[model samples]
Target: MLLDRHRSLLFVVDVQQRLLPAMGGGEGCVARIGLLLEGARILDVPVMASEQYPKGLGPTVPPLRERLGNAPVFEKITFSCARDETIRTAVLGTGRRQLVLCGIEAHVCVLQTALDFAAEGLDVSVVADAVDSRRASSRELALARLRQAGVRVVDSEMVLFEWLERAGTDEFRAVSKLVR
Candidate 1:
């Protein structure tokens, strides 16, 4: 199903400092996520951010954190964001059924979170190019598994364009600039 902007929530899970360098294609993943953030801002989509463990992994990478604005930022030790009480509550409170996901360690955090969200009956759409693991194979496998479990596997531009839903409007104009 196509994501409805008004019914969608953006979840950026643990794109931290210490963990990123080890990830394959991590920089490009972060860049795509930045595009998602920019598009979300233009479309008025709600964003929820998480840092796995701030004391150890460091903050949510300065570039992304800066774009987060006043969106709720939850700190958690849980691998699956859905398993964290605060993050789970915030997500449920948004009342949105469609979740657009991005973040790190696709085999671990991203994988578990996507599975949990799916189990909860949320329509989860993961931006494939916006997430990666330390090993390229692990990332690919996790994405394959997620898709097998019924998640919408998509790319960054697909999401932004879908969220825009049309051309010629001010939101579309602003969002188009981000992906371009």
Candidate 2:
């Protein structure tokens, strides 16, 4: 399944400073997620970013934070973004069932949150290129686990195009610039 503007939300989990270096391909994850955020903005999709233990990991990377603006951003100690009552409440408030998920430590926070969201019956799709762990094996393992749990694995472009749906709208033109 793909993201539908009306039914989905972009969930950017902990892409923190102290944490990113520990995440496999961390730089690439941030870059891909930044692109997703840019596309989401052009498409008018709501976005939520979370920083796990910011006191240590630091804030969401500067570039990403700059792109996010004042969108709903949450800081939590919980590994599962879903476990943070505020984040969960905020998500529930959006009433968006299709979740476009991406972030760091794929085997832990990202995995746990995706599973929890799925357990709540929400359709969770993890951006394959936007998630990572310190170890390549761990990232691969998390992807395997997420897939096993029925979370649809995809990439940032898949998300943009899926939300675009058709090619002629102004939204499509704006998003196409990303691929260009």
Candidate 3:
């Protein structure tokens, strides 16, 4: 599907420092997610991030922190970021239709947030490769459930290329190198 840069927002969910290392194949997902963010930057997609109770889990990773230095980040006690007023307000304030998601504990924060957003009648895309649950079975179940519920599950590359869209835009060359 076409992912218009102006109509979409990237939501990085609860990929806190302590929780991150425990996600299955998480290190790889984190690095790929960083690349995804880079592509979004080149394409000019706005981004919002979240941390699930930072006092206990810590902040987002250093690489992501540096890239998104000034982007607003909300700390939440709820599993679903939709439950956090600040995050909800910040996301709604963006005036974007589609929410593209990526990050950790796929069955918890990622899954819960996607379900809530979808229920809010917003189009959602779960970047499969960019999300994790720490447990293989749990992630697999979450993905299946998300699909059944009509959330469009995708990979980082899909969102990146969709944002780029055409072959000749200035972002193409830079984004092309990313997928390879």
lDDT of each: 0.91, 0.90, 0.88
TM-score for each predicted model, relative to the true structure:
0.98, 0.97, 0.97
- Clashes per prediction? 0, 1, 1
Per residue, candidate 3 scores C-alpha lDDT tens digits across 1-114 of 578888999989887789888888888888878988888888889888999889999999888887775778888999999988888888888889899999988898999999
**Tens digits of per-residue lDDT for model 1, 1-180:** 788899999999899999988898988999999989988988899999999889999998888998999988899999999999888888988999999999998889999999998899899998999999999999999999998999889998898888888999998878877766
Which segments of model 3 are wrong by more than 4 Å?
Answer: none
Best-fitting candidate, scored by lDDT: 1
* Candidate number of the best TM-score: 1
Which clashing pairs does model 2 show? 24-133
Error of 1 at 44 (Å): 0.1
